[model samples]
Target: METIPSSDFFIQFWGVRGSIPTPGKDTVRYGGNTSCIEMHVGGKRLIFDGGTGLRVLGKSLLKQGPVEAHMFFTHYHWDHIQGVPFFTPAFREGNCFHIHGALPADASSMKQHFCERVLHSNSPVPLEGMHADLNFYELICGETFKLDDITIETRPLNHPNGAMGYRVTWQGHSVFYCTDTEHLPDRLDENVLHLAREAEVLIYDAMYTDEEYSNPKSPKYGWGHSTWQEGVKVAQAAGVKRLAVFHHEPNHSDDFLDNVAIQVQEACPGAFLAHEGMIVSVV
Candidate 1:
């Protein structure tokens, strides 16, 4: 694993968009790639999801030579796993990746899902062509595990085919990655609250606006996505320090997001919209 000194904790957003990749002039400011994020904590490299942004992140990692990281996936959705085939580091000789994810709803292991399902349809070469030391670790929702000095907790989320949320804590700071989850109408999600309670940062799925979510013309209810307004509620209820409004709606253009940013700031004074290439430090 690539190591860093000190007790620094950082979260970098490689992709912030949700659903699908939207590359165009209108989305240049926020981002075009689907969900991927990187976390550096306690001298360890941690990655969340394998969206298209992972490919871009891979290119940057090449400058650092051979590397190792712990990769975690929320679900096997196409938008989340499409970057696996293009992640350049995975095809390199000396690189290593310890992949982790909750088992598929079906009777398959993490390796089977990634190698057979994800890679089979996307990659041009077989696993043999990828020279990296790849290791897959199966995870269960609501389970807690220790990664060296880091403590990670996983919980189930409300999403189609189910998705998992992760809470990473090291030293005393914590960061919750809770994307692709839908909020309950009657009450806030208790599962999300448990992982995000009093945390330094909560990276949430805010893929629609209240207006967009409930629009009679195109209702987003039960779509496994939440609005930024709901994200603020979760933050306040959990006593979270900062809320990162992530998982941008694919069709939301830069100008559209710029408007949402203002609304988010107004609703939650401490919260801000998450954007591509944005990095937040958890202190």
Candidate 2:
């Protein structure tokens, strides 16, 4: 048996965008942030992804002082890793960061995905100079690992760039994070469903609307993302207790995302949208 948090394990979203950051008037309510999430378990803090949301989360973490951090990256897509250089902790020598990610299918190594100047070289910011003690690991699908009391499982996602989804479990409760995945023949897979089955919460990619994603003219079928309806279907099929619609489309306005949330609730009964600062506790 694993040791669990002291009755206070929680997960919080710091960023929730699909492809890029879209901060502006229309996105303020639901937030146009990118993909970063924080987990607090057994007094340990683990960060998932380092998208634009890391800029803000980094500031908050700086104020909180030195602490160990484990960062999990779904993939090396720009939107998922561009904010690592902006994370304040990376500049502090006292901080240590363990970064875990999925290696590109054809790439020689995972580092090849993020180390080229063609990606972030034009900008003044670069990840190479970060002062923190950094360690990187590549995770394989079906492999299980531990952090504090939590057990984690990874699976490849149906994405053009080969992204991955994660399932984190603690205290016998689970939360599955599936961002930036496209629906293949079906939106959900039995392997993924099994990983998420009876989960306390399932945070999923909800970057398009059924009408937008399924329409012949608008379908982003090859784009590696899904609509709210697809997310609901996956959650229901997985037997998740609650569903969190995450990775909102950059163009989806607050009102638009809100309506999607309502519709997801209508479909799944206990569904909600994942905002920049929302914290969820699962017993």
Which candidate's TM-score is highest? 1
In order, the Cα lDDT scores of the candidates are 0.90, 0.79
Candidate 1, residues 151-225: lDDT per residue as tens digits?
999999999889999999999899999989999989999999999999999999999999999999999988999
lDDT of 2 by residue, 1-283 (tens): 1233355567888888878899889988777779998877666677888888988888888876676788888777778876776777887888888778776666665556555521366646666677778777778866888876888988878787687788888878888888778776644676567677889988888888889987996667788887788777878787899988888888888988878877787888988998877778776
Give the poorly placed runs of model 1, Cα more than 4 Å off: 1-7
Clashing pairs in 1: none
Q: Candidate 1 versus the native: TM-score?
A: 0.96
For candidate 2, the lDDT comes to 0.79
